[model samples]
Target: MRSHHLLPLLLLCILFLAQCTKEEDTSPAENLMQEASKISYTYPALSTEPMQKASTLTAAEWNDLANWQLWTPQLKLGAGRLVQEKWHFALQHRYTVVLTDSLHKRITDARITLETSQGTLLDESRTDNNGVSYLFLTAPTKPEDLRLKIVYADQVFYIGDLNPQNGRIEKQLNIQRNVSPVMDILFVANTSLATADKLVYLQKELKEIINKTKSQSDSTLHIRLGSIFYGLHAGNSVIRTHPFILQPEPTLLTFTKPYTTVTHSPETIDLALEEAIYRQAWAKNASSRLLFLLLDTPFLQDPGTITRLSSLSREAARQGIRIIPVSMGSMNLSGELLLRSLAIRTNGTYIFVTHPEEGLSNPLSTISTYTDEPLNNLMLRLLVKYSKLN
Candidate 1:
């Protein structure tokens, strides 16, 4: 009654334990498959055909044509464009206020307030690293009826009877303080299986551009660089983000290395862009914030695609961050439309590199020149008038 019963009970217990171990060992793989199945890969119904005759266009032509307004005539000009044509000659007034020290050095972080003649606040913003603030007004409120006030270094100065309709207004304070302009740039690359061969070319072009931009920067302007590499492998998302740094060569090398890992399809571009917009260490008072996205894959139109894209683009626009998307190879209509919309929403540029294997040196050069210029300038008459202000 003792030995025989104990032997059977031990055998049963061993079989149960082995079964439990087997389930535990296989659960992880099962869970992964389940997750992969849950992912909805809804490609847009539009054709995947690439743009026609894109390869014939020169780099300079591409630079001029990359604007979103040219691509979509129905939509208004992007917010990034300072000068926009008024529809039907409507009274839409946009004013730029530039503050400078006596020595003509741009002032940073100065509090600017626009008020009405009746002591009502119209808008308020702090001057960016470029010592510029933007005030937008619509019809029924003329610039002549608005007054501008600036507060800097605990001192307040006031300018009344603004006439920005003619051009931007510049005010030179008697103070001698100067602040260096700050700019931040981040490069986001898609290192998936589809773009494996083009990574080397991209890496070389990026390094060259980085060096060029660095050489152009002097003590007057400070530049910080960062990068993000994104891919999907084995039903999991892989994203590598580097913080802003003075030197990003090592990070770029590691990110753009030869791709031997096999990646899954349906790029997580939305997630990569979300990380770029929200997770990056952008300066609060940066004069310019830019993101250069290189990708050939289209976004997976999942359930959260619209909401995520809308929120990300709005946030980028609010922060005055411009996104430059460079489509590396032949892109589908869906991908083109999405990227184009993002650029327009954020006042950014959408660039299509018809030949990715050739590298991006030409386009990068164009971008460098474009970013080096100032966003706004006052007309000669306005400058003359402003010079006489107290």
Candidate 2:
């Protein structure tokens, strides 16, 4: 009887130990799931009503908006440039170079090199389709010490030995060559289920703008419009890209496609942004490269996502691609921070769609109030007068 009792007790203790080991093995995964749940739970519901008045931002307001310190602390991890004081000062000292033909027409695809009198190359950039290039000089580097070497259409031009003070400098180069201004605008849209309704509104606004722009016959400005639609479905990111075209009808069709097949997962914004940055067919010698990102979803906050975004922003800036992020719905904290970071990083502007139902014309009127000039013309004016470059 004593042996039988001891055998049963031994088996019972073994089973108890096995159960404890199983719990220990699953605890980490369980904790991760709980944390994810908590994050989603804390997110506020998407707002149905407009949150802000539709108005234009002044130069002072734009500066405040670009300040990264005003954003959430989480943004600081990926966007180090915005937090650096040196980088901010460098932006202020930026100089603009505009190359034009003797007839005043812009020259495209011009290679510009900035160097010291000693031939130490400081920085170099190619003129965009708009015939614009930007260069920066740091402390201890006087404007008189700077020299420029420009190569365009197999001809080389040099300009140097100048005296410039602490204020902004705008240099004009009248090359012997002439090229028409080419503008390429790429519209990126999020097609996730959460933002389905906003997509409809965006399509209407885009159609009106496209028609209005096309109606204004500015032979000097050549405009090509394209679009990209992105979403997540069946654990995969789906992206459809349309190349820049002079016609708008086919490009507008993409915005009408239904996204009901999307899975329960949130949008793959990182992949969408990556596609917008790399896969699009931007004109090589175009004068302007503009990317308008429209979305209502919050981006993933994972480290990998943030790092990728940072890298993409830098690349876009290098390519002279301006990214304008337009918020379609009431903005959330995380969404606003990420959008603003991208805009600021690429030296682009941010717009909030306070009243989608009212269309983007009134809100964007500040961009171009004149019907004859249209949006792109106004954009160029803003670049010259306010932002100072395309």
Model 2, 185-225: lDDT tens per residue? Answer: 88888776645655654454455444444444344566778
Number of clashing pairs, model 2? 3
Candidate 1 lands at a TM-score of 0.54
List model 1 lDDT by residue over 154-255, tens digit each: 788888888763447899998875443566778788877666655554443445444444443443456677888887655677888888886555544445
Q: Can you list the residue pairs that collide in candidate 1?
A: none
RMSD of 2: 16.9
- Evaluate all candidate structures by whole-model CA lDDT and list the values in order: 0.53, 0.53
Off by over 4 Å in 1: 1-72, 76-177, 219-222, 249-253, 257-264, 285-287, 301-303, 356-390
Q: Tell me, what's the RMSD of every candidate?
A: 21.3, 16.9
Q: What TM-score goes with each of the models? A: 0.54, 0.59
